[model samples]
Target: MRIATGGIAQETNTFQREPTTLADFERPGFGVVARGEEILDLEGTGTVYGGVVAEAKALGVELVPTTYGGVMPGGRVARSAFDTLRDEILVALRAALPVDGVLLVLHGAMALEDHDDGEGLLLDAVRDLVGPDVPIVAPLDLHTNLSDAMMAGADAFVGYKEYPHVDMPRTGARALQILAATVRGQARPVMAHARLPLIAPNQSMVTTWQSPLKIAIDRAREIEREPGVLAATVLGGFPFADVPFAGVATIVVTDDDPPLARRLADELATICWDRRAEFAVRPVPVDDAIAEAMAAPPGSVYVLADIADSGASGTAGDGTVILAGLIAAGARSAAVAQIMDREAVAACIAAGVGSTVTLAIGGRHDNLHGPPVRVTGAVRSIHEGGFALAGPMGAGTRSSRGRTVVLEIGGPGGIEVQLTEVRGHPHDLNYFRAFGIEPTERRILVLKSAAHFRAAFEPIATKVIEVDAPGISSANLANFDYRALRRPIHPLDAGARWSPGA
Candidate 1:
C-alpha cells in the first residue's frame, strides 16, 4: 500500500496581539518546515511524523513524505503564512497522487487571522483533491477545536488522549492504522464529533492525574475497547482561541457504525459537561505561591508554574509579575526557566559575563501580560538557547529559545533569571540543564508552562503550584475580550447549559 503524509500544525491564541507569520514557521531550532525526505528525520522522534513513519515502516507501506510545517502555539496565524503552508502541503500531495491514503499530522485548534478554522480549511482542500474514495485520516492534539468543516473533510480523526500530549506518536499510529484498515477493505470508518459548550483551563486538563479531564479520557479509552469502536478521544479544547468552536469536544470513530460513534461521542461529551465545574482552576497569587515554597522543607525543590505566561499556550514567555514578586520578597535560591526579552539578552551579551548590568527585562511583548521589571544583576553566562528534549513529552525533538543569557539578581544564591531572545516552552529539564542550571538543586523553579512541564518536572518537584500571574493564557478568561466566541460557554457563564443535538 502507498500512503502520503504531511500537514501544518499550530495552536492559535486569538487573544495574543502579535500575528504568527511565515518567519515564525520557518524559524530554525524553534519552528519546523520540513519537506519530502526531510520529513524522514522525524522517524525516531516522539512526534506525529515519527509515529507515521514508524507505523508505515512496520506495515511495509510505501510512505510519501510531503510538506509539514509546525511551530509552538502562538497568536492567530497570519493569512499569508497560512496560505503558504496550505499551498505547500497541497502541492506536495498533488505530486504524491495515486496514493492509497493520506495521513495528516495536525493541531486542530489552528486559527488564522482571516479564518477561524485553519485546520478545517486545510482538511477540506485535501478532501477535495483526494476525492471521496481515498481515505483521509488525521491525528489531532488534545486541545482540538472541533468544527463542522473538519468533521466533513476527514474519514476519521484520533485525538491525543493525554494532556501533556506524551501520546502524539501513539495517536498518529492509531489514525494510520484506521486508514490502513480502510484502504485494505478491512473496515468502513464512520466518525462523529460532539462539541460541548465549555472551555476548561490548561491546569485542569492534566491526564496524568485523577482530574475531570482524565476521567473523560479514561471513559473514551474504555469506549475504544468496545466492539465496532475504532477510536475515541475527549479534547479539553483550547480556550485561548476566541473562535466560535473554542470548547471541549468528544470524537468517536467506529467501523461502519455512525449511530454508535455519535452515541459514544455524545456520552463522553455529557460526562465532561457534568463535571464542568471541576475543570475550573484558581491559581494561587504569586506572593502566596512563593511563600508556600519557602515554607516547604528546607532543601526540597518546588515548581512554580507561571501558567498565564505559558509559551505553550500562546502567551509571550516574558511576563514579569512573578519575577516582580520574587524580587520584591528578595527570594533566594530561585531560578526562572526563562523570560523572553531580546533587548535584555542583547544588553547582557554586550555587557560580558561577570559584568554588572541594570536593565528592564520582560513585559515588552504584550500589554496584557505584565510590565517590565527593572533590576541590576551580574551577567552569569551567555549561550545559544537550543536544547534537545529529554522528557516524556516530545522527547528527542530539538527545541530552541534563540540567544540566551543568565543573570543573577541580588548576588549569589539569589534569583537567577534566564533571559532569551525568542519565546520558549520550558517543559523539559533539558531546557534548564542546557544552561548549566541544575533544577534539582534549586529551591524554587519558576517555569512558563501550564502542565506539560509536569511530565518531566513533576517527579522531581517536591510541590507544584500554579501561580496567578497576569498574561493572555491564564485561566482568567475575563482578561480577554472575546468578539467571535460563541456565547453562554460554561465557566464563562455559569448559567450555560447544553444537551446532545441541541
Candidate 2:
C-alpha cells in the first residue's frame, strides 16, 4: 500500500497583530522550508514529515513525498499563502493518485485570512479528490478545534494523548495502524463528534491534573475496548482560535457502530459539562508568584509559567511581567528559557562567555505584554542550541534554540537565563539539555508556556506555580477584545447558559 503524508500546522490567534507568512514558516533552524514547487523527499529529522517517514519505514509502507510547511503560531495565515500551500498539496495528491491512503499531520486549529475552518476546507478538498472509498486518516494535536465538516471528510482521526505532545510519533503510528486495519478489511470506520458548551481556558486544560479531562479521557479509553471500537479521541479544542466551533470537542471512531460512538461522545461531553467549574484556573499575580518562589525552602525548584505569552498557542515568547516581578523581588537561582530576543543574543555572543553585559531582554516584539526588562548579566555559554526530545510531547523530534546564549544575572547563588531567536515552546527535557543546563539542578525554572510544560517538567519540579504574566494568549480571555468570536461562549457571556446536545 502506498501512503502520502504531509503537514501544515499552526494555531492561529485571530487577535494577534502579525501575519503568518511563508517566511514565518521558514524561521531559521526552527521550521521547515518548502515552497510551492518543491517535491520534498522525506528525511528523518525532528519535523512532521520526519516522524511520518520513520513510522512508514517501520510499517514498511511505500511513502509518497509532499511539501510540508509549518509556521509558529500567530495571526491568520495569509489567504494567498494558505491557498498556495493547499493547492500545492492537492496537486501532489492528484499526481500521486491511486494511493491506498492519505495521512495528514495537522494542527487542526489553523485559521486562514478569509476562512475560520482551514482544516475543514483542506479535508473537503482531499475528499473531493479521493472519493468516498479511500481511507483518510489524520493525526492531530490534542488542542484541535474540531468541526463537523472535518469529521465528515476523514475516515478516522487520532490525537496526541499527552498535551506537551510527547506522543507525536505514537499518534502517527496509531493513524497508520488504523489505515492498515481498514485496508485489511478488519474494521469499517464511522465517526461521531460532540461539541461541549464549556470552552476550557488554555492554562486550566493541563492533562496532568485530575480534572474532567482526566476523567473524560479515561472514560473514552475504557469505552474503546467495547466491540467494534477502533479509536477514541478527546479534543481539548484550541480556544484561542476565534471561530464559531472553537470549543471542547470529543471524537470517536468505531467499526459499524454509529450509535455506540454517539453514546460515547455524549458520555464524554456530559463529563466536561459536569466539571466545567473545576477547569477554571485563577492565575496568581506575577509579584505573588515571585514572592512565593523566593520564599520556598532552599534547594527546591519552583516552576512559574507565563500563561499569556505561551509559545504553545503561538504567542511571541517575549513577555516582561514575570521577569519584572522576579527582579523586583530579588529572586535568586532562577532561570527562564528562550526569551526570543535576537539583539540580546547577538550582544551576549559578542561579549563572550563570562563577560559582563547589560541589555534589554524580552517585551520588545509584544508590547501588549508589558515593557522590556533591563538586566546586567555575564554571558555563561554560547552554542548552536539543538537537541532531540525524548518526552511524550516532542519525543524523537529535533528542535533548536537557534544561536543561543545563557546569561547569568544577579543572584547570590547564581541564576541563569536562556535567550534564543526561535519562537517555539519548550515541550521536553531536551529544551534545557540543548544549553547544557540541567532542569532538575535549578532552584527555579520559569517557562513561557501555558500547560505543556507540566508533562515534561513536572517530574523535576518541587512545586509548580502559574503566574499571570502578560501576552497575547492571556488566560483572562475577556481581556481580548475579540470581534470575530461568537458571543455567549463560556466566561465571555457569564449570564447566558448553554445546554449540552443543543
Candidate 3:
C-alpha cells in the first residue's frame, strides 16, 4: 500500500501581538519530503516525520512524502501563510492520486486570520480532493480545540495522551495503525465529538496527576479496550485561543459504532464537568515563593514558573517577576535558563567569559510582568549552545541556544544567578548541559515553564515546588483583559454548571 504523509502544525494564540508568518516557518525549519526509494534517518525535532518514517518502515508500506511546515506557537497565522501551506498540501494530495491513505500531524489549535478552524479546513480540503473513500488519519496535540467540522472531515483522529507530549510517537503509531487497517479493508472508522463546558486553566491541566485529566485519560484507555473502539482522545482545549470552539473536548473513533462512541464520549465529558473545580489553580505570590524556596533544604531545587511569559503559550518568555523575587530574596546558587535578550547576549560575548559586566536582564517585551533587573555579574561561560535530548522527546533532537552566554551574578547577600539568552523552555536536562551548567550540582534551579520540566527534573530534585510568576498565561484568569472569549466558562464565570446534553 502507498501512504502519503505531511504536516502543518502550530498552536496559535489570537491575543499575541505577532502573527506566525512564512519566515517563521522557514527560520524554524520547513517542509521535508522523503519518498519510497529513499532510506533517510529522520532525527531531531523533526518528530512528525520521524514517527511517520518509523511506522512506514515497520509496516513495509511504500511512503510518499509531501511538504511539512511547523512554527513555534504565536499569534494568529497570516492568511497568506495559511493559504501557501494549505495549497501546498492540497497540491501534494492531488499529485499523489490513488494513494491508499493519508497521514497528517497537526497542532489542532491553529487559528488563522481568515479561518478559526484551520485544521478542520485543511482536513475538509483534503477530503474533497481524496474523495470520501480514502482513509485520512491525523495525530494532534492534546491541547487541541477540536471542532465538529474536524470530526466530520477525518476518518480517524488521535491526540497525544500526555500533556508534556511525551506520547508523540505513540499517537503517530496509532494513526498509522488505524490507517493501515482501513487500507487493508479490516475496519471502517467513524468519529464522535463531545464538547465540554469547562475550560481548564493551563497550570492546573498538567496530566501527570491532576484530576479531570487523570480520570478522563484513564476512562479513555478503558473505553479503548472495548470492541469496535479504535481510538479515544480527550483534548484539553487551548485556553489562550479566542476561537468559538475554545474548550475541552472528548472524541472517540470506532467502526460503525456511532451510538457506542457517543455514549462513551458523553460519559467522559460528564467526568470532565464533575472534576472541573479541581482544575482551578491559585497563583502563589512571587515574593512568597522565593521565601519558601530560600527557606527550603540546601539540596532542594525550587521551580518557579513564570507562566504568563511561558514560551508554550506564545509569550516572549522575557518576564522578570521571578527574577525580581530572586534578587529581592538574595538567594544563592540559583540558575534560570533563557532570558532571550539579544543585547545582553552581545554584551556578554564582548566582555568575554569571567569578565564582570553590568547588564539588564529580562522585562524587555512584557512590562506588565515587571521591569528588567540590572545586575553586575561575571560572564561564566559563553558558547554556541547545542545539546541533544537525553530523554523521551526526540532523544537525538539537537537544539541551538543561538549564541548563548551565561552570566553569574553575585548579589549583595551572596546569591548566585545564571542568566542565559536561549528562549526555549527548561524542559529537558540537555537545556542545562548545553550551557555547561549542571542542574544536579545546583542548590536551586528555576525554570520558566508550566510543566514539561517534571519529566527531566523530578528524578533528581530533592523537592519540586511550582512558584506562580506573572506573564500572559497566568493562572489568574482575571489578569488577562480578555475581549473575545465566550462568557460562562470556568473560573471566569463562577456559577456556570454544565450537563452532558446541556
RMSD values, in order shown: 1.0, 2.8, 2.6
List model 3 lDDT by residue over 105-150, tens digit each: 7889998887888898888888888889888999988889988788
TM-score for all predictions?
A: 0.99, 0.91, 0.93
Count of clashes in candidate 2: 7
| Model 3 lDDT on a 0 to 1 scale | 0.75
What are the lDDT figures for the candidates, one per model? 0.90, 0.77, 0.75
TM-score ranking of the models: 1, 3, 2
Q: Residue 1: error of model 2 in Å?
A: 2.1
In the range 389-480, model 1's lDDT, one tens digit per residue, is 87897777888899999999999999999999888888899989999899999999999998889989999999999999998889887767
Instruction: Please state the error at residue 309 of candidate 3 in Å.
Output: 2.3
TM-score quality measure for candidate 2: 0.91
**For residues 196-265, could you state the per-residue lDDT of candidate 2 as single tens digits?**
7557777766668766676788787787788888888888888777788887888888998898888887
lDDT of 1: 0.90
Question: Of the candidates numbered 1 and 3, which has the greater TM-score value?
Answer: 1
Worst 10 residues of 1 by lDDT: 476-485
Model 2: how far residue 95 lies from native, Å: 2.0
Off by over 4 Å in 1: none
